[model samples]
Target: MVDLRGIRHPLRPAGHGRLPAPPAVDRVRADGRRRQGLILGWRRRATVAVATVALLAVVGCGSTVSPTPGSSVTAPATSATASGAGPAPTCGPIPPVAPPSGLDQAGWWRDRTFYEVFVRSFADGDGDGIGDLKGLIGKLDYFNDNNVASQTDLGITALWLMPTFPSPSYHGYDVTDYRAVNPDYGSLDDLRELVKEAHRRGIAVILDLPLNHTSDEHPWFVGSKTGTGPYADWYRWSDAPQGNGWQPDGSRFYYAAFGADLPDLNLRNPDVTAEVTADAEFWLGTAGVDGFRLDAAKYLVEDGPTTENTPETHAWWRTFRSAVDAQVPRTLLLGEVWDLPKVSASYVPADLDLTFDFALDTGYVGAAQSGDAATLMRLMTNVTKLYPATSGFGAFLSNHDMNRVATQLDSDPGQLGVAADLLLTGPGVPFVYYGEEIGLTGAKPDERIRTPMRWDASSPAAGFSSGAPWESMSDDPPSLNVADESASNSSLLSRYRNLIHLRQLHPALSSGTWAPVASDSSSVVAALRVAPTETALVLTNVSTEPVSPTLSLESSPLCGRPAVFGAYGQTVTIGPELTAAGGFHDYRPVATLQPQSTVVILLGP
Candidate 1:
């Protein structure tokens, strides 16, 4: 596994291993009542006596809800309003957004928003103070309630669950049993139930599969240590310690890329390949997961001294892809090739259905931090040229391994909003880390980055658990927790909810050709999302000063006036189109973007 912290060392302390059996507590069902409590609490806090004119101004056309002062943008209205006219929204079945033209309807992952869930730190259903499948199951509605009209849910279409297999470590990366579920999380049956529930809400579930290595305590590694058994040769070994990654297993040294506790599996062995392939089949065919987030995909089959992006790695992925396709036709293989766009793109259209764009992630975070849009604009232009299509890449801000985006931006909600706007509006599938919506802040040392989800600010455990949390909650939960933010229309959570649902409502924003829009100001980044029947103009002012960028949309396919779909402290003015000598219409669009704000405009037929 490539070090997430940019350090090639074990994240946990030495002697860190499986946690002891949790003390049994009464199982709490994450049912409608619990979900209602969360919504009602938000309503109670947000409700205020206001003028009728203000209410009318706040609720715009097409279910738009005006955000509070200093908030980011307009969000869709949810059932749980400040008025509290009905029951609070709950976790329940939600329908998937319809696929746009040229996209496969069966490939439900495309044009969808995905949420990365670290199961252990998500929620505690059994009062064990650790997140489990049952807890996740209850919270599925918070991700997507399947109601097109409801704005309470996050409107995520897919989930990328961190490893759930039984392992010897807390992170669950080093698998001990590929087939069995981690007892700390739940049973295999609980996993099946989770898949069932998620699917019922039209949410696709993909597991984190670290095929490169297994825990040293695994049977295969245990048997291979002696260099004699049915599992002999299952792991690479040598008479002497070969190089940097080799660890002493008695007299013989074995390859352990991440650490000694995790042994690299000899995937070149045919039997090992077959066994791993079968394990994948088990999850798809039996457990009913939709796909896998292949961890450290580029380092799967290392060559001598060159342990990353090897030719053998591509070949093995092809073999794995073919085998999985033969068994399960539409299963997704999303790889984590944490490298430049060129290297990450090489694995797509053949080896993996999609790969995370590490370069884009850097560009996005950097632009937000520096407030200079030139680098981000250049990167987006290059990305449009490099990838096979927009769907081939996955765009994200920060993940569990990196410092939280909020912390990276120094907890500035405006900058956070700008970053989120770029991620959702830009091409490729977007993945949101848990608690990112409410601007949860955390820095590295890994555990802090993967802290418990802050459900309620007032709760002792931040509403993640009735008992003690697996890890301490992030520092600013009082202002950043879900309950408080859900109530405030101007909160970061509202901005995220608006942006996510806006993507769902518009096809071009989700799956369309990206073309850069030339802007006069270096602080403003602009692009056009063009589809057959729809076109969207996304403009962001990365700087802290208002920028009225004169956009050169001469090369864009847009024609006529465009309407504002969503705006945050921005106003648009459509400039007159001029006919050029080549019989082409040259269009100019001008937008006055507020400091650290974004606006989405739609060009209709």
Candidate 2:
């Protein structure tokens, strides 16, 4: 059937799976028209063996949850009693669950906060009307204040850059040259300097690698079309054309699962895998990038219905991971699996270090908007069990593929605070999309969602670029820009900064095991984070009206001191309430939580 001579490398292992196909959308034309396009995807698998160092040894254990300029709201004098208290609060560490089947116990990811950057919209160093590497270089201080005592930096430790390689498309997903940087962004030297500067501030840089397909204009595809040289078998082809992607090319038909100008790489061909692997090595070894966001990972290898999550695909990822780990032992591999948690989580313990947690994204947003605390609490409880104990997902509210979060929550400041509280306090490595901190909002047609970062409201271009932006800025920049929000004590930008710092300060909130504290109200999602040294009770009132919900937990006295809070700074009081049948203590608050507010209480033993 298929030739195996080139691919059956001795070190390569094997694996398999199936994923629901992603919705197919039109590829944007150079003229900006919507036409049928290939699906952009990301793939991943595990390594046969970890070498050089004990992966578990290099990674540290634990996590923390965020902060702002305002003071924490103090609790009132009244408290709840065990006998009158409704549901008894569940206290203590949740049993240490087993790591997902093959989870690599590399915990280094726990300490990093990933920030997604769409290069074209980030900042423009040149007056070419497009954001470039030099512009990103200039903004490094914004991410880290360079050891400044003020702590004004965004404090993000990892950067997930959308594809940086040369491509014919504006999105850069249909890569034309794997080894070179797109001239629109900058030169290879510019990228090197960017990486060097980022590392100088203790930040890790990871480039998005689109490995599923290449621009039809790629030399390998052109060569393969003629069935000449080693490139002859570099892409999928058939004499009797079949399936959704079959397209005519000279004497034979080739497959393009995404854009018309893109051709799916025939990863079954060992040469293709070898070449892609080499490209990764170049970036990791020569370019000095920390890792990669594997784009379009699901469509790596097709089997019958579609080329997604097939056994061969997992096997290839394993080989790929091995090659990368061999070069950089601590390098991270985050997969872009835009599927359900069950489907995406399947890639972990072996395949990827993390997958974007779409469940939490949708769950938190939905519950926050509708005040359905049960749904949010259920999602959190389930996800904690689904993922490996040692590994975690990329907790995010919104990314380039989806509508901006501010747009999702209709720009409600309280809903935004609830979202930030859920994501930063929950267990996982969180990624904040650029401009999200300033409450950026955008909707469909794609370009709107990728608008330029709003750095200043006073400037005509919002301080993102001196020249015209590649895309227009969001209309409300004057009120929502970073320049204005950074100064306000109660602004969304200040909220995000404070929240991030909160996590950096507390180890329990970040890496600790999560246990849901039973609450009687449907409007509030309350839970406790328990670590060896500390315990915290997090409460969110997803309602628009002030509601006082009882939080029943077995823990001792709550300090009545709010560790971190958002929304209306109402006073909260924790007192003894009625007891349940089990004699567990009920903790009810004396103060009402204002609509859309969240509070974190540090409990004492």
Candidate 3:
């Protein structure tokens, strides 16, 4: 394997390439002011109130390997089509699922880690220059169950595929047919095989569901223009337009807040809601998709100029959740609410399984760049209270819509590692943007952000495809390819694997109650993960210099000697004063921490 472990690297800080600013729209962008708006706005709109993660917890202690699932014994059915000429290909009955209990549960999403892939650029198995479901199937082992020597699998438990439906745009957001897989990507059978293989490996597949809008080319949208079919009222229509949503037809105007091509669906219509419900049922029941990443979740109902986080929007999601629950109990519905926690909190438990936390991502990176533990802790403190006990947040460093994490942190591996630590060990479900684990760098126009996966340094398209890839490889694939990172012990890929493995092995890290580690100063940001049988502390030093902070447990006492776990394989133990009962103890005070390093200590039951 090609290895670059010994190479010395420059401390590149920001400006490697200009990171793209978030979109101008308030809902999509996750800026400080918007987060403040979400916080302040959440208080104004609040109907209710709200709310780590060790080791065998780090590595599998006595974990049993799940058997590889067998291929379909029955012959695959022919493509299902509602209309022979239409692009909407209906799905056939899915094979029965004997789903694993621990990781795939609805409430258990917070305990799992997810990786997002834009299928068009993820992998190209047929050498046709576009990534398809088959290509993604080919790369499933890289996420988990490869067992390749010297290679570190990312160990992500869930896969979030960006919109795979028939759409006019490259991003697949403006869907023309919700029931059909894009012909360019693959066929319905190909998706079935991918899901089967993913399930076999114990990974849940989450498809992107764009419920708010449809392509102008969609049959429903077309019928709406004529105002002469059942679909005439499927989309919001008006003789006169308003705000950003008024798209001009021959004589009438339709609502399309995103653009003229994406007309917002009329959620107020029962027929529209029924269609959506049936569409979701097809994917969950017939296609066997484990969950969904609901797109434009916050913009379902607009009030004049205000079209975000409305009461009707929240109620509709509750209804949507009920439909999903009927089909597949405990199926995940991860909402794409890029707004701040306060504003996003309105949809928790009742409306969604989770909401994306952009503030945690941006704030953590900002703190890591400056090595400011205090700021990171402050952000975490606020975030810890943003959700209900039954619901969780979706946390990530970068995504398909934004600049890649490596570029945002200026390619600093240390800062990136700290960011990963915060995501993996902190309180929320973590979603890794495809190729982010290997330091894949890209910026906006979205195509760059959704660049192809780098498998090998020498492959023509970095082993993503034999044909010309849709986007060019990032400037330095030699240093970032999976093969190179897998060979190196000290690679970002390795760190991600270790962290995920730790999360899986330790219940405390995955689903435990969270409390920040009390320290005198903010140089060291730490938290205690208290589970029923497991107790551990996750500590990170964000500063450039070593820190020896006075640390103590806020609630329970340290019962035993701390067992250290971290990226660099360091040994750490802190002394605590023993109480008479032998279980509780007070910290003797200070513990030394390494710069830009994370340490997990097992405090014991």
Estimate the lDDT of model 2.
0.67
The TM-score obtained by model 1 is: 0.81
Q: Per-residue lDDT tens digits of candidate 2, residues 81-191?
A: 455443433233222222211112244566467799999999999876689899999998788655534446776667999999888778898888899999999999999
Clashing residue pair totals per candidate (backbone < 3 A): 3, 49, 8
Per-candidate TM vs. native? 0.81, 0.79, 0.80
Better of 2 and 3 by TM-score: 3
What clash count does candidate 2 reach?
Answer: 49
Scanning candidate 1 in windows of ten residues, the lowest lDDT window is 1-10
- Superposed model 1: Cα runs more than 4 Å off: 1-106, 559-572, 575-591
Give the alpha carbon lDDT tens digit for every residue of 152-191 in model 1.
8887878999999998777899999999999999998999
**Winning candidate number (TM-score):** 1
- Give the higher-lDDT candidate: 1 or 2: 1
Give all candidate RMSDs, comma-separated: 14.5, 15.3, 17.8
The ten-residue window of minimal lDDT in model 2 covers 51-60
lDDT (Cα, 0-100) at 134 in candidate 3: 88
**lDDT of candidate model 3 versus the reference:** 0.68
Q: State, as a TM-score between 0 and 1, how close model 3 is to the true structure.
A: 0.80
